[model samples]
Target chain A: MSEQPTHHGDRPGSPPDGRPDGRPDSRAGGSSAEQPAVTASPSRPATSYRTLRLGAGPEWSSGQLALGAVSTGGAALFLVALYFAAGGFDLIWWLLVLVPVLTLSMAGSGMSLGFWALMLYGWFLLTDSGSFTWWSLPAAAGLLVSHAATALSASMPPAGQLASAAVHRWGRLIGIAFSAAAVVCCAAAAIHGRSLGLGPAAYVIGLVGLAAGVWLVRTNPPSQPH
Target chain B: MVSQRRRTTTERSLGDWHPTAAHARAVILASVCGVAAVLGRRPDLLVIAAPLAVAAGWGHLARPRAAVTGRAALGDATLREGGVTTLVVHADPPVRQADGVVTLASTAWVERKPASGIARLDDDGVAVLGLRSLRWGRHRVGTLSLTLTSAWGAFRVGPTDLPDLDICALPLPSAFDTSAPTPHPRGIVGQNRSSHPGSGTEFNTIRRFHPGDRLRRIHWPVSLRTGDLHVTSTFSDEDAHVFLLVDAYSDLGPREGIDGRPTSLDVTVRAAGAISEHFLRANDRLSLRTVGAADVAPIGVGSGNHHLRRVLDTLASIAPATERRDEGEHAIRGVDPMALCLVLSPLIEPTMVALAHTLASRGLTVIVVDTFPEHLVANPANVHESLAWRIRLLSRAAQVHSLTSRGVPVVPWRGPGSLDHVLRDIARRASAPRMSRR
Candidate 1:
């Protein structure tokens, strides 16, 4: 909780050391031997700065750092790939992926970034081919739209509304739909396959997504913070 | 009064120091880079350039003539802890932009809240920001740094200082005190010998004098039965006036201590504020004293809203001494005799104990409200000044007991419901009764 305006570093006043963060002087607030009962916040801290720091105390966990690294790394790597390939060089492409990658990169604690990453990569797969096959074009567009919708938990059209939906079940349903579509697309490619480079790499990554869907159903991390 | 007026001047004011011209140049360069990126179809260049542009634009927006006829308007100059306050920014020939930092000269905690509004030169050139809430005492919102620029971040000029802004934040009534002991003595004659008046305490009812009764207990009721005079004897509930002294030495604790940076002074301040309010509510005039240098007169003999305000302001501004081994010697050196002097402190020295005991011997009531300093524990391995700490605490505790044995009921103030009741009930039953909360 927050405290009153009068700030001493400790309950009794402050530390003898100039280090504001150091331990208090001897006999600071009779606070030894027992953890004081959590004092209720007198009031929300004078809400000044928009951002807050959850100090570098024990409260900061390694998991958070791990999440940030994973997110920023993923975005930077994919962005580099797209930049190096440098297709039509459309500025609009920046706008397309900007919201997802940037938002994901900035606030690293969420599944929202993962969903966007999936959609961006799906679009990248189709666009790089430079050939608009009837199946491929629709599949790419649907892939982006459905993935983004699932991420945002949105209902797009008149047919999309389904009341009484459970949050986890709804996510699983969407995953199954994507899995079906992916399996069909892969099967179609095999039927008239272009036996070429990086094709094997695409198949492997595709199987990974399919395997992840099953794992996600088994281990459900809550969408909200504990 | 005119002679008393100190000419307010700032030799190192924001007005005198404008940011170097180089800060503005950075903005121009960043903007040029933005244009280059757009022309060259380089999206990556644009990303790197935008933040730079914003930073540069910020400088440009901030730069302006530092000069202004600044008049600061504030909501309620006095504030209690956690009470909301507002500061209105106004300038003549209007500053193109209004922004500055608020520094509290005499407080443990205070903050300048975010504010936004438009200041049109053609219109009312005013901006308002909420100070929201503050901790305690009169504080000067001295020379705020202001940088003026157009809203667009196009052309920043120079930095100016907001002038003539000072405020007083009153101490708030605190509800947290978790350090009182229980099952206090009852039917007791407290340290203060002089009782206010009538009581139904330990003293028993008078009995009619019998023929063989002791001459000391010959009641008038019995005398009337036999048409003879008689003497009555019984104890009177004699309670005393308690003076709660708080050691306001600096270096007591952190500004924001383990408890949300609540300084040691903050705790002492809160304790003083709460106890004063409590005593005042109990129909007693409380005398507040802060030890160390810059000593102020103990809050005079008084009880009312005005008295509380005075105590709060005094407590709010109290700072710990920068020196070592000091107590309330200067503040209460020759103070009025206290019935019950409730001293709230860590008992940091033998002097504090000597002071309490000396007061108690004079038949002035003294109750030591210990501000527990033992909470400042940490590993000695990494600490530099680890030696000579533990020895100090033991000597101080001994000092407190010395006074307690002399009849001053030195009680450690623990907080919360039942214990507080016991302390209050015991005090009221004795002398230091508190006003019941409505």
Candidate 2:
């Protein structure tokens, strides 16, 4: 069963201390105790802003700071891999290191798609050897962390202080998502190293695997109410 | 006279859900890019698309199963100007990850704290907005709109508009009072002391004790000195009838709210409230009639606290310039012959002036209260408008002179003590003998 809605405690007309003497104020139509019946909104922490506070200062809590560090650090590590993958000659590859900072601040509304695609292209260009590399595994981990962080940051309001429980929950989800990418990376590396020359049969198996992955992604799960 | 139904608690059914651009972007980018990466023999592209694939999969898996509905209610329906009331908006089957916004559209004379009129829902899917009415009268509080974004801002339900809520804002009465009594006392119960002697507190004289005199009323000192029983006599308490005819034809001046100067209609309605409050508290019978607004509900003659509320409610229902079909006849119909008729008007309307003359012709004590705002003459913003008003007011001056010549007093509303001098004069005139025209 859903929890009963809590009273909005900070109503301006409500008494600051408590119900006023249990006697109705003729002007207010009822006592302070009866005010709860009138103003029954969900309870919120006193610090929560009433409106969406855009462009507000970053009042980072410990949980938010930790989450921010993990997300940006993962993105920065992925950029280092991309630097080596791009042969480390061009100065342009170094600019990719700042994707983490952009993800930290300018995350919302799928705006981080550009950064994600750029990192993927950096990995794609490293395929000049015409063979899969084991380094793709760590690169996958870094990209997954950055994506999860962007999603988390977008979900939160600008001035919102993160609750520890929410951060932990998102962290668990991110871990699970990265684990799936890691599993796929391991399978690809095994297939590439084995040099399986099964020809048309191998192509058939790969196609089947791709189909299954797409089906799993497309399939809807039975939704449960909160 | 504007008639409107009272608002009650209601809930809106869930609105149609639509896929947001954010959701589509994640799905399209993930699926198309993932398939192309495998075709191109690139595992790196697969990694990039994996998280987005998870996002798309999660959104579809966790979409809201049931329809999302919203309910809104006001804590109090009636409020004095500047008094605050709470509005609560709630969504059913709360989506833990969803972000909901509650918006109250901007309305004239209603001040919202945030000014933008938008508020964020708490985790439990409820939002609270405070509304303060700046002016008096029956006003529709702004329309409430609710929008909910669920599943990582992927799926959405409504920016659906809920039903309009209304509030009755009673005018804060202008400070007014009078020690002088009403012109004509007719009813048996009231605070006014009449000429005839009966049961009352104020002493008229001492007389020899009659057979009907109670022992409590006997004056022992007078009896002992005169060698006969004597009793104190007092004037009987009576009540007066006050008939208020409000003119709602024109609302002059800029429609500034309570913080600024009042308009002509504002002055009239507030003056009527102050007069009604003062007389009602004194236990006087009051009746209200509106000439220019026909939609306003009719109020009959009554006394006591409950009747006082009815009077204020009727006053709050006034909508200016609504009763063009109303002639002065319906307003004066069934009015008590002995009642002192108070015609509240700006004197710009000829119908109001004619109504006052008609009341006087019917042998009723009539008084015209000029409710034009002082700022109209003092602060004319433009030269053309000032010139126009000056000419119009000159014509209005002749109308006032006509009413004065017809034995009807024309007095401007000045809040406190505005009617004290006129009411005392009417009472004095009522005491003198006069011939009635046949």
TM-score of each: 0.45, 0.76
**What 10-residue stretch in candidate 1 chain B is worst by lDDT?**
B114-123
Highest DockQ: give the candidate number. Answer: 2
DockQ of each: 0.02, 0.13
How well is each residue in B202-285 modelled by candidate 2, as lDDT tens digits? 789999999989889999999999999999989888899999999999889887766678889888887887788778878899
TM-score of 1: 0.45
Give the per-residue lDDT digits (tens) of candidate 1, residues B1-438: 101222222322323223322222223333443444334323333332333334333434454544545455665555544444555554545643332222222223444332211111212445444442344545565444333333222232233444555555544444544233211212233322223222323335455444665675657667787777664534443332436677755445444422344545666666676666555544455566666636455566666556766666667566557334564566556665534456777667556667777766776545676765444534255353323555556666577667656665555545333135435545565455648789
**Chain A TM-score per candidate?**
0.30, 0.59
Question: Candidate 1's error at B135, in angstroms?
Answer: 4.7
Q: Model 1 scores what on Cα lDDT?
A: 0.42
Q: Which parts of model 1 are misplaced by more than 4 Å?
A: A1-226, B1-68, B93-108, B115-123, B132-143, B147-158, B176-240, B257-261, B322-330, B333-338, B378-392, B416-438
Q: Look at candidate 2 and tell me the lDDT of residue A85.
A: 56
Model 2 accuracy (lDDT, Cα): 0.69
